[model samples]
Target: MPINSFISLFGRSPIGPMQQHIAKAHECAANLVPFFEAVMAEDWVKVEQVQQEMARLEREADKLKKSVRLSLPKSLFLPVARTDLLELLSVQDKVANRAKDIAGLMLGRQMAIPQTLHAPMRAYVQRTVDASAQALKAMNELDELLEAGFGGREAALVERLVEELEDIEHDTDVMQIGVRQQLFKLEKDLAPVDVMFLYKIIEWIGDVADRAERVGNRLEQLLAR
Candidate 1:
């Protein structure tokens, strides 16, 4: 079947708007990899390039978010509550917003990643991105779950995906702690201002994953209802 026909059959699917948000959120999250890479390499040009790209993606996500919100009719009915769907959309948008914040800070400060903290910092970024990806995967299953009426095998599968997202988020938290410790060790050697911004950067990076986990948790709640 043509994809459009298939989509038309499920015209009321909330998954459509949710997936549009997720796609942009994932794009925002994925850009962080190259953003950090450029920062680590001390290549200001490349860093600016990636930062611009992140900003563009963020703008795109914001537009889609507005579109989704405005397009949702007050009388429209679905398998899930409208408020739950709105909450889920809000949480998903946060993921993209946090990514934009990270990129903006990196560009504004041009903060250098210390060699000792590089490995742990990169690990944190990767894990956080992984968590967001896992959350997206769970959101992707929403259509199937709705088709299954939120019961039986499909429900179980989505629950498992949520569990994996939580696990990855926990691991990112650990990675953040280790990275902070390494940063602490180098604090005395670095300028106070640089150290302060570096700490902020670390905190913001972790926020990305934190928000992603919230997305999963919100979805889990929706499933429970």
Candidate 2:
């Protein structure tokens, strides 16, 4: 099948459903840092805006999925661009949802991050977001790589993204431990439920990085094929 014909059949294009979702994923990943920073700093207005934007993007992604399902030719798309795009979008969308999930946890628990804990957590999340952005950027170059049908730079870049995400994940674990240690020391003033909520949000946020890493892995697999 001609590439254009395949794309029309499956709703795939240079700036089609997959590209749109991936782009939003990068934006969400980047914005999450400031979203949490706003929470820690007690900036309610910014938090509300970022949270809304995150929710809006996620909803739009879902709509796109439904559009693909109802409008595209399924048999023609299996194991091709449509399937690849769907998988990529699903993974990317998870990051945004996770960010929103963390925000919801903050609201539900009225948990503001400790001042001393802010710096390390902020740095870790920023790194994770950057890694996810890089992963998405790599995805943008995928078509070019496939067209060239040649070099190993794209593969190498994907490997580097995975490594960077691993480092980010490790840093998140360390920060989580440090934050818990400090919280433990001051546990007399805080309720156990609040502490658990805090930990839960942290874990979800960490999963955003994990999802981003998985995106890099998927891109690697697709490019290799």
Candidate 3:
């Protein structure tokens, strides 16, 4: 909740501040590591700990996002159009938003990950977090892009990072399919409602990666401009 990153979301060139914001957003996604562990262990206490922390992080991201909306168009020297910068910020924020959503829904339902799902589900959650991590890595290059005037070597480097993020997201897709297949095999043993929510959880986990890749896509658009 402390979110020291809020100081720079668009302070000057919009690069440094955006970097900070994504770092915070990615923090929410990264928390899923411990969260899934707690869930698999059926440790509701630990689950709540991670969930509360994520809520704090999401709140911080939301505050910074609102700040960006309120503080723009004054003295900030945005290299890209104001709308483009805001779009990137919005995408980055969704990473945290979805992470929070996954935790909230899972906790509220006291959702249990089937024993058969434990392994693939853990891998799935980690891979999704990895995607968000990659998104943050690409955003970290924004300052360098600004230095190079959004051209030359720095822009290329960011493009490579985005490409890697895409690959991670693709891998996530494959994993989701495999996990669903496993779930289908176990569904007859599970309650109909539980099976439905399990599928939804799987989908929401993938949403984390999907939204993370969208951040990279948004940045690519900025680079094109």
Candidate 4:
């Protein structure tokens, strides 16, 4: 390649595209709020509509991830380790994947949460989505981290944001416990198979939050390098 062409290719920062990908991931996760609502409303039309949109967003994120990987420079002159950036991208990808999984399984089964569990389950899903949102907020600072060479004030701000993400994850954990307890009390009245899936849905909600926190964890790791 010509020297000018090489410079232009390598000069393009990967940070912006990485941030775009996470925003899409979080958007998919955030849609779960409406998804669960439609399920509670027993509005199959709306539920299917929302799930298709989320699936679309996830696909868009996947395309961006692939583009980032292919265009990312392999040069040692990059600000962050190329491998570390790739790993972070992989973790970020899972947030969308997990969200897609929840939508697919729930929609496929036409699953319904018991009326009594609806309120808490909705709250649980919102908080879980909040985790993904927090991850995105922290990730938006990647350009600043690069500008500051990943240190000092910009780095401290990112650390604090990650800490907030951790706290949100903890709240989701407690909420999960409360939800499971409520479901346990009502399980006998519900179909045994439905109860089983309800428990799995609850666990999967927690997994969304868990994967979001890992995005924060990856940011912290990058700082350590």
TM-score against native, each model: 0.93, 0.80, 0.92, 0.94
Best by TM-score: 4
Per-residue alpha-carbon lDDT of candidate 3 for residues 94-208, written as tens digits (9 for 90 to 100)? 9999999999998999999889889999999999999999999998887767667788988889999999999999999999999999999999999999999989989999999
In the predicted model 3, the residue pairs found to clash are 8-17, 9-17
Local accuracy of candidate 1 as per-residue lDDT tens digits, 2-59: 3335446655555687798888988888889988988899999998998888888888
What TM-score does model 1 achieve against the real structure? 0.93
Please identify model 3 stretches exceeding 4 Å from their true place.
1-11, 74-76
Model 2 residue 169 distance off true place after TM-score fit, in angstroms: 3.7
Candidate 1 least-lDDT 10 residues: 1-10
Q: Where is model 4 poorest over a 10-residue stretch in terms of lDDT?
A: 1-10
Report the C-alpha displacement of residue 148, candidate 3, in angstroms. 0.3
Which residue segments of model 4 deviate by more than 4 Å?
A: 1-9
Residue 206 in candidate 2 has what lDDT?
A: 74
Predictions ranked by TM-score, top down?
4, 1, 3, 2
Q: What's the ranking of the predictions by lDDT, best on top?
A: 4, 3, 1, 2
In terms of lDDT, model 4 sits at 0.92
